[model samples]
Target: MKSRFLIALALSALSFSAFAHVGEAHDHGGFLTGFVHPITGLDHLAAMLAVGVWSAMTTRRLWIAPLSFAALLLGGALLAQSGIAFPAIEPMIAASMLVVGLLLAAQVKLPEAAGAVLVGAFALFHGAAHGQELADGSALAGMVAGTALLHTAGIAIGLGFRRANQWLPRLAGAAVALMGLNMGWSLIAG
Candidate 1:
């Protein structure tokens, strides 16, 4: 138990450090950049991980939310690539973290369709925000693959914590939520 708490604390602390790089410029032309983007950005990382945790908590289906998120994320990127305008994408991305983080912390269970729609909606914003920067086909594929990996990690952690200590995942969720709130405030303040 002590070790688990320590691990969670370390993750929470690392998340804060990771959050500092949200808007830094990265080479946007390759698979490596797309792959590294989400893991390096706390806003995307927390939201994606929360989606997986929430999906794991559901009783019906495990893949629906993640699939919905991935598909819609791609669609959003496509829309952006095609020159479609999506206003306030950054704010929406931050909001995704807050909303998803709260849902994960509460362990909210929704019908699969509702879950898909909810996750998908926020996913569009995330997709658009990054999509504008990703112009390469391989980069898009890399982003999708990287996102899928994060979802898998979240699901695994969710399942493991479910059997070991229920509060641990919830604690992680709260930390994510707090990070989201901080992110949102920074956007507003700056």
Candidate 2:
């Protein structure tokens, strides 16, 4: 079962090339594009998954962080759609990856509410960034659905890792953190 799960996870992770980019003109619109955006963007993907993994490892109530993240993500997107500008969006998104990744790696357990607030704050930025690019209401729904699906996947991965080996999740978290660091550096240096 573990091997099968690992294979599936590996395949899913490698199935798509990164396709989303900030400031690029998207000719496509609607649900499909919105759904694929989070999966295709490395920053979004990493952070979303890390949220799930961290949540699973730390909290007895597994749903809180992911729920908070999804809710705030939608809110952020709506705010962006309404033409409200959020400052430091890209930087903050990058920071989400770093922060979440570190939290997972360190296995830090905060109160569920605190964790929810932390993840939700980051979700707002992520939602705003993606929301500005989408064209319709359906797309927003798709994005949120897709994000929730990814969170599910992350939770599964976290659980599998926890059962298989204690260090596995931490290693995954460290990898996520490294990715975040690289992403942040690219944003800064680019």
Candidate 3:
């Protein structure tokens, strides 16, 4: 069972490479091109998935938290484009993954509003990262939309696993937190 879960995760991670750079130098204009950016990158993927898993474990209102995250992510991207700098944005994003992962692993339950706010804060950083990658042109909207779709997909997967086995959520959470810690260490090392 564990191996099967790992295989699923590996497959999901592999899927990311296909959509990693939605609007890079190459201009492949299509829905799939617009939708693969978020899941492609490890940092974005982990952070987004953590939000979903944590929200699922902590809140009764499941959809609300993820939706709030999507909305705030868009807002953050706009802020990034406007040169609104956030201190420790990358570090914070990594921390978010770690915190959310820990919460899920421990099965800690917080109020719905608190969970939303927490995830929203992280979403801003994630969005800003995506915004930075986007070119300043018509592709921006599509890129942003694509990122949101990827994020939503990650959340959905997390929620689905959470429903199947109670332990699965915690295991997913631990994986996310470990990934975050790796990111944090990389940032510090560099």
TM-score, structure 2 vs. true? 0.87
User: Candidate 3: where are CA atoms >4 Å away?
Assistant: 1-34, 136-140, 151-155
Task: Give the number of the best model, judged by lDDT.
Answer: 2
CA lDDT scores, all candidates in order: 0.78, 0.82, 0.68
Local accuracy of candidate 3 as per-residue lDDT tens digits, 50-150: 67666665667776777777888878867877878767777877787788778878888878888788888888877776666664544456655655565
Give the distance in Å from residue 126's predicted Cα in candidate 2 to where it truly belongs: 0.5
In the range 1-190, model 2's lDDT, one tens digit per residue, is 9756754564454333232354553534788878987887877998899999899999999889999999999999889878888888887887888799899989999999999999999999999888778878888888998999999998888777678776778767776776666667767877
Worst 10 residues of 2 by lDDT: 11-20
Candidate 1 regions with alpha-carbon error over 4 angstroms: 1-27
* Clash-forming residue pairs, model 2: none
All candidates' TM-scores?
0.87, 0.87, 0.77
Which residues of candidate 2, in runs, are more than 4 Å off?
Answer: 1-20, 25-28
**Who is ahead in lDDT, 1 or 3?**
1
